[model samples]
Target: MSRVEARPIAEILAEVANAVPDEVIGVEFERARRRGAEVWVYQLKIIAKDGRLLKVEVDAATDRLLVAEED
Candidate 1:
């Protein structure tokens, strides 16, 4: 069993949904990842109306954006 307890995916999704930009047209859950005992990474697939797509990683514990590349 893992020593660190992670926040629920629904809760994380809610938080992430709030953090996402309003212009985003849609969102898809990519995957949930863990780095040893350090952090939980939540990857989201974001889509825009202009046909733009992005993959973002957010920290589950703190609800912080760990990575999001814009182009």
Candidate 2:
């Protein structure tokens, strides 16, 4: 069987920095269903400078931002 390797963490963090520009509080790797297929994701918990908590998800394979919202 073949496997999809996730992108490097440094690259993922850089991508997140560009998208969020906030202090990341936590990070986790998760397997989720997207378009009915399983995909790997990086779930980030962040704190905005304005004091709002945020949640962000990035696709591990493509370095794409899947979701970002204030929590």
Candidate 3:
């Protein structure tokens, strides 16, 4: 099924890149089942400047950050 997004995936990636200023290695689009509705989310895998790997998810509709994890 196709996912719905407020903006283009590139724009979402750009927003993430702007916040981290790191190398984005991988990106994935996810459809989350929420209250019987499918919500679009963008996952950004980044290589931090400090050499740590990070994962960030953003809400496609609101452009709000959902999660940010580093390893």
- Model number with the top lDDT: 2
Clashes of 3: 0
Give the poorly placed runs of model 1, Cα more than 4 Å off: 1-4, 21-37
How many clashes (backbone atoms < 3 Å, residues ≥3 apart in a chain or on different chains) does model 1 have? 0
Ranking by TM-score: 2, 3, 1
Error of 1 at 25 (Å): 11
Can you give the lDDT of residue 15 in candidate 2?
80
> How many pairs of residues collide in each model?
0, 0, 0
Candidate 2 vs. true structure, TM-score: 0.87
lDDT of 1: 0.63
TM-score between candidate 3 and the true structure: 0.77
Best by TM-score: 2
> TM-scores, in order shown?
0.59, 0.87, 0.77
Instruction: Estimate, for each residue in 1-71, the C-alpha lDDT of model 2 and write its tens digit.
Output: 87665887789998888877889999899898888988999998999999999998888999888888887
For residue 70, model 2's alpha carbon misses the true position, in angstroms, by 1.9
lDDT tens per residue, model 3, 17-49: 677799999888888765577788878888988
